[model samples]
Target: MRTTHPHPTNAVEPPIAGTAEARRVSPNAGWWRVIGTVLGIMLLLVAYYWVHKPLDLSLVLRLGGLLLDLAVNIALFVAGGALGRALLASLNWAVVSRGERIAFEALAGLGVISTGALLAGMAGLFRGVFLWLIVAVAFLIAMRRGGGSWLVDARAFTRALRPIDRWARLWGIVACALLAMALARALAPPFAWDALNYHLVGPARYLSEGRIVPAPDNFYLGFPQLLELLFGVAMSAFGRDTVAAPLHFGFGVLGLILVAGLVRRHTDVRAGWLAVALPLSATSFWLLFGWPYVDLAVFAYGAAVLVAAVNWREHRETGWLVVAGVALGFGAGTKYTAGLLAIGLAAMIVVEARSRALRPLLLAGGVA
Candidate 1:
C-alpha cells in the first residue's frame, strides 16, 4: 500500500498567516514612522517660530555686548564673593563655607548693584559701563590675592554630576533641554504683556536716562526692581532690553539647583532630580522663565532660603541663618506672593526647632 501511493506535485500548502500579516504591515509601519518623525520636526519648527517669532539678524549681531556684560557681571559676582568670604572668615562670621560664601556674594551683588543703580540714578551717575567696570575691578583687585578659591567648589560640583545615577542623568538632560528652549523663546521679542508694558520698559527707561524713573502708566515698574537692575545694567551697556531674558532663565536654573540640593538631604539622588524636574518641566516655568516675570526670581530666592535654613540646621552655623535671611528678604522683595512662602517656611522652622528656646525664633524673626 505504501509503495503504490504517489504524492500530487500540484498540492496547495497552508499559508504562513503571521508572515503574511507582518509583510503587509511592515511597509505601513515604516511609512508611519517616517510620517511621525516628519510631523515632529515640523511641530518643533513651528513652535520655535511662534515662540521666537521673526528672526532678527540685527539683534543677533548685537548679542556680543550682552555676552560681555554677563561675563563681567559673573566675574564681579565671584570677586565680590571671594572678598566677602575673606572678610567673613577673618571676622569669624559664623564659619561659612566657600559655597555659602558664594551665595552670600550673590546676595551682596544683588543688593550692591540695585543700591548702586538707584543711588547712581539719583546722583546722575549710572550712564555707562565704566561704573560697573570700576566696581568689578575693585573687587577683583581686593580679592585677598590667595588662599581659598571662589570657583573651586563649583567646579567640583560639576564634576560630581558625572557619576550620578541614570535617572539623574535623564532628568538633567530634560532640565537642560527645557532651559535651552526657554532661553530660545526668551531671545525672541517678549510676547509677555507684563514684560512689554513695564519690566522691559522700566529697565529701558532706567538705562536710557541713567535713572530709575517712575512709571505711572504701568504698575509693574513700581514693583521690585532688583531683578531689573541687573537687566538695566545690560540695557545700559547695550542700549536695549536684549539681555534680560537669559538672566531670568539663569534664575530658573538656580531655583532648580537649590531645590534639588535641599531635597537631596534625606532621599536618593533620583528623588532630588525629580524635585528639580517638577518645576522646570512645567509649561508655566517656561512662560515665566522666558519673560521678565519675577516668579522665577521668587523661585530662586525661595529655594535659597530653604536650603540655607536646612544648612543652618545641619551645621548649626549662624552664617547659614544669615544667608537664609538675606535670601528670604530678596524673595519677598521680588514678589508680593512670596509672603505666603515666607510664612510657610517660618512655620516649618518653628515646628522643626520647637525644642529650642526663643533664641532660634528670635534670630530667625529678627534676621528675616
Candidate 2:
C-alpha cells in the first residue's frame, strides 16, 4: 500500500540516460557511410587522372585498336579452352571443384592450342586466315561435344559465390590492382630488355619466314619455344608484335587462376585469394606479365601439372596422371628451366607409387 501511493509497483520505468542520444547515432553512422563511399569514388577518379593525364585523340584512336586486339586475343583463348574441354571430357573430375576443373581445362586448352600452332608453323601454315579457321574448328568441335554443360556449370558456380570476408577482400583488392597495372604496362610499346633481345625477336623472325627456321646466331632460339610459337600466332593473327604482350598477360592471369583454384581445393576460399595476391605481389612476376616472355607460361603449365597430379593422387586415376604428364610436357616445352619441375614431379610420383611400384615411375618418366 505504501509503494502504490505514488505509482504501481509493476509500472514501466522511464527511458534510461543517453538512450535517445544512442538512437540518434544510427543516422549519423549512415551519413558517415555515405561520406566514405563518395570519398572512395573521388579517390578512384583522381587515380585515373593521375595515370592518364591529357588523354588525347591519338590515345583514343589507339584505344580502339587495343580493344580489338584484346578481343581477338580473348576469343582465341576461349576457343582453345573449348577444345581443351572436349579433350578432357572423359576424365573423372569428381575430386575437384567446378572452378578448379575449369582452370585445368583452360591450361590444357592452351597447351593444345600452342602445340597445334607449333605444328602449323612447322608446316608453313601459320597465316592469319588459317589461324582464324583453326579457331572456328575448335569452336565447332566444342559445340558439338557438350560445350553447353560447362557454361551451365560456370553459371551455377557464379550463383553460389558469396561475399568474401575482410581478409579475402583485402587480398582481392591487391590482386586486382597488380593485374590492372600489368595490363597497362603490356599496352605500352615493347621495351623490356629480354623481350627485345630474343623473346620477340625469335617470333618476329619466325613469322617473317612463314615457318619455323633454325636461328643459329640467336642461341636462345634453340631452346623450347612452345610459348614463343603462341606469340607468333598472336602476331600473325593481329598483324602486330604488340598483341603478344597482352597474350603474355593472359598467361599470367591464368597462372594466378590455377593457383587460386589449387589452394582453394587444398584449404579454403580465403586462402585461395591470398595465394593469388602473394605471387602477384612479387615485382618480377608481375612485370613478367607485360613482357613477351615464357616465364609466365612456365608458371602456368607447372601449376597445371601440380593440380592434375594432386587430382591423380586423390583419385588414383590414370587419366589424371596423363593430364599431369601432358602439362609437364608442355611446361618443359616452354622453357628448359621447366625440366627442374619434371625432376621434382617424377620424384613425387615415385614416392607416391603403391609400394614404390615401377609402373607409375615408368609412365611418369616416359611422359615427362
Candidate 3:
C-alpha cells in the first residue's frame, strides 16, 4: 500500500502515536488569532523574565539574537552533514554498511561543529549570517548535484532496528524522550554557573576582541576550548546565547552510535542492539543534558579515534590512522582527559598487533 502526503512539509505519520512528528498547524488563515496568541505568549515571557530580574531592550535583543545564532548554526550544520554524506560515499563501504544514515548524521554534525571551531580562528570578521549563509549555500549546491538521501538511510536504519528486542526498543524510546526534554529545557536562557561565566562568555569576548587572547582575571580562559570554541563562535556570530548543549549532546549520541557500531562489528545482532539501547540507562549520561561540560565531546573524539584505529588495523588504511590522530588531537583540545585516549590506543595495539602499533602512535603523535 502506498500512502501519499499532499503537503511535503508535513511529516509522514508514524505507526506509533506521539513517537513521530506531529502535524503542522498553519497560521496563514487565522492570522489575527495567531497574532493574538503570539502577543499573549510574549506577555507570559515578559512576566517570567521580569521575575528573574527586569525586562529591557538589551535583554530582548540578546534573546532575539540567540534565535539568529541557532539559525546560522543549523544552516552550517546541514551543509556539513551533506558534505559528510558525499564523503562517506567515497569511503570503504564497510565502515557504514549497516548504519549508513545515522553515521551520516553523526559525521555531518562533526563536520559543522568542527568547521565552526576551525573557521572561528580565521573568521574573526566573517562570523555573521551573511558569511555562514554563503558557506552553507555553496554546500547545498554541491550536495544537490551529488545524489543521496538522508531519509532513505534513516528509513533503512529503522527497518534494521525493527528486529531488536521489543523491551529494549521501548526502553530506548523512553530514554530518548526523557533526554530530549532535558536538552529542550536548555532552549531557555542558561541557568548553569559555568555557562554564565566562561563556557559561553569566553567565546563572546573572544569574538568581540577579534582573537583568542589572554583573560588575566578569568581562570577558565586558559583552559582547553575545543567545545567552548563552538559555543563562543555561535554567541559571537549571533551576539547571543546559542545554547550549545544540544550540539554537544549530538556528540554523545554519536558516541552511542559508534560504540554500538563496534559491538555490532564484533558481536551478534542482539548484542549490538543492546549496546545501542542500554547506555540510556546510565545516570552519567543524564547529567549532560544541556550542560556546558565537555565530557561528551571528549568521549566523541576518543570514540572516533578508537573506531578509526580499528578500521586502520583491519584495512591497513593510512587515512584511518590520520583520522584517529586528528580526532585524538581534537579530543585533547577539548579536554586534557582526552590524552588518555593515546594511552588506551597504545594498550589496544599491544594487545592486538604489538609490532605495528608504533606506526599509528607516531602518526597520531605528530598530529596531536
Give one digit per residue, the lDDT tens place, for model 3 in 1-368: 98986878667654443332322243244666689999999999988877877757798886676576457556545555555566545556566445633553445445445555556555554354534554555466547845236545645765765546776566567656766766665555676777778887777776666656678999887788867766664565546665576566666766766777787778765666566556656766666756766778787677778887888778877767766777787788888878888887767666666776676678767866
What's the number of clashes in each of the models?
A: 0, 0, 0
What lDDT, from 0 to 1, does candidate 3 have? 0.65
RMSD versus native structure for model 2 = 11.7
* Candidate 1 runs further than 4 Å off: 1-108, 134-138, 145-148, 355-357
- Tell me, by TM-score, which candidate is best: 2
Candidate 1, clashing residue pairs?
none
Local error of candidate 1 at 162, Å?
1.6
What TM-score would you give candidate 2 relative to the actual structure? 0.80
Which segments of model 2 are wrong by more than 4 Å? 1-57, 148-163, 354-356
Runs in model 3 deviating more than 4 A are 1-73, 85-90, 97-123, 129-163, 268-270
| lDDT (Cα, tens digit) per residue for candidate 1, span 224-260 | 7777776676566556565677667666665676677
Evaluate residue 160 in candidate 1 and report its C-alpha lDDT on the 0 to 100 scale: 65
The residue-level lDDT of candidate 2 at 47 comes to 93
Best by lDDT: 2
For candidate 2, lDDT tens digit of each residue in 1-368? Answer: 33435877688776554577654645476677789999999999999988887688898878877886798777767776677788899999787777777667777777777777777778987776665677677778886897546656656765764437988888888888898998988977789887888888888887777778898898978889888877777887767778888888887777777788888878887898899889888888888988878898888888888888887777888888888888888889999888788777777787788576577767766776
> What's the lDDT for residue 114 in model 1?
58
Model 2 lDDT-worst window of ten: 154-163
User: Ranking by lDDT, best first?
Assistant: 2, 1, 3
lDDT of each: 0.65, 0.79, 0.65
